[model samples]
Target: MSHVSVSADQAGQRVDNFLLARFRGLPRSRVYRLLRRGEVRVNGGRIGPEHRLQAGDRVRLPPVDLPPPRPPQQAPTRQLDELGACILYEDERLLVLDKPAGLACHGGSGIRYGAIEALRQLRPNQPFLELVHRLDRDTSGCLLIAKRRSTLRALHEQLRTGAVKKRYLALLTGQFAGRRQRVDAPLARYERGGERLVRVDAAGKPAATVFHARERYPQATLVEAELLSGRTHQIRVHAAHLGCPLAGDAKYGDPQAEARLGDIGLRRLFLHAAELEIAPLDGVGARHFSAPLPSALESVLIRLRQQTLTPSPP
Candidate 1:
């Protein structure tokens, strides 16, 4: 049996919510199942799923042994340096990496392993490296990895309390109206067969993004985006909603315009998580980290700059 105690800060939260927050790898459905089975109790009394927890509540959790660990697969034969892994910053608690385009943040679907696995192999003793958050496979730039579970929990708390700031660099297909704009819209997920996508819907969770145009050209605009809420595909959907879909975003861009850009080097989505700022867990000042533009994206920008010098039709 596991004895769990609630703190004053965790008061008023549902029992299931508290369990979910405490256990990282456990699924929410399983948490409810344990509650339903009366495997969980509070202060020597069995509580229902709707029980509202109060400060100093002692929670009794049934002993739950985690499943056996899976055998580690053989490391891939690819050259580690060729993977383009670059370290932006590193400390005892965390490592900020510049994730390259075309690599998944973590394995899913048919892919077996990802950068996290490779990094683990590179530093086997430091087995606690874990992704704090995720970035899309095609999106390149600053990704955070926590060195220990305690640091991960602290970083997650900061994210929940709005103490962390994230910014992205995007190349859009058209010129935006002003230097800066904010998009406040809700996002909902839609399933099409086996595929899932997010769209702006009134009934969905509240999402907000702020965009600032750094440079404007006839064909594309370089914009910086700051996320106010961390929803799936929030920035992509919000930018697409403004009719300035990102260049090479096949999922949401204009097919005709994409075809026209076949001659250019705009082959993949031109979005990168360029910067991240996190308040220090020790109550020190804020810490900021940034990843330089990957060569692929930088080459595209160079071409765009040359295009700007060319004369356009009246």
Candidate 2:
């Protein structure tokens, strides 16, 4: 029973995000339910959840039950401070952080207090905050945040045009040949027993990743991967297809290598978003950000190197 007008600042946002942002305590499932039933309309016409809003458009919001917001449900101040300390670079238009592993990029999908939620809580005064792109929850490293919708759109355009680049470092189970190798395979996402997974399928969308072997061990190889075309699980799936699944990747991994690495220190997914490069947007100059490998991962490599140096039993 309420109507809202989309302003210039609100343009380019998905209707779902706009609704969730406006209704703090709104249940995501409830929002989707309303959207599916056409209860939520824009410009007097029904639209799906992914529909983007435009300036000067009128949206009709039907009445719905919403729980009162709770302070306990919010992220703790200590965690927020820790996330703040991870900031690698911040400008009027963009913010970059060294996102740690196990912390998701955003909330929902059974996740609570993700990076975006924590940032919004920490900087309550900031009007605009949106993810420029998303990294897997198990993957750690450089993440981008756009402070304005205009900046978000510009960066998205750049991504579509291949102007934005990201470098990922992954530890594969088997020896990877060649100094640099490119995997050009399509990928498709499917669900099995309620768990979502991706695989290389001939009928899927085109995907590509270029990998540079950085270091090699008797049983493993460290490689830097440059994403040529962004796709879900492109690096992991491609690495597996190359006969060297990533170490510690339970979903798509080599079990024997996992057992071997367990002796050293491969306890988690060995993928890291090491670098990100954004080409100049409008008048803004190009920018680059990097994050060193986490110390735990560093220790794994150090131990592996030592193992390789030791003479085999005679």
Question: Which candidate wins on lDDT?
Answer: 2
lDDT against the true structure, each candidate:
0.81, 0.89
| Per-residue lDDT value at 129 in model 1 | 84
Query: Residue 9 CA error for candidate 2 (Å)?
Result: 0.8
List model 2 lDDT by residue over 53-112, tens digit each: 999999999987778766534888788888998999987888998999989898776676
* Cα error, candidate 1, residue 102 (Å): 1.8
In candidate 2, which residue ranges exceed 4 Å CA deviation? 22-38, 46-50, 67-78, 310-314
lDDT of 1 by residue, 1-314 (tens): 88878887567667886787666447677888899888999998988877878889999988775546556654465635644358788889888888888878776466667778777876779957888888888888888898976677678778778888999999877657788889999999998777888999999999999999887778678899999989988888999999988888877787776765556777788899999999976556789999888788888877777888853322
User: Which runs of model 1 end up more than 4 angstroms from their true locations?
Assistant: 1-70, 74-79, 82-85, 310-314
Output the TM-score of candidate 2: 0.87
- Backbone clashes counted, model 1: 0
Total backbone collisions for each predicted model: 0, 1
Query: What is the TM-score (0 to 1) of candidate 1?
Result: 0.80
Every model's Cα RMSD, please?
Answer: 4.6, 3.5
Model 1 C-alpha lDDT versus the unseen true structure = 0.81
lDDT of 1 at 193: 77
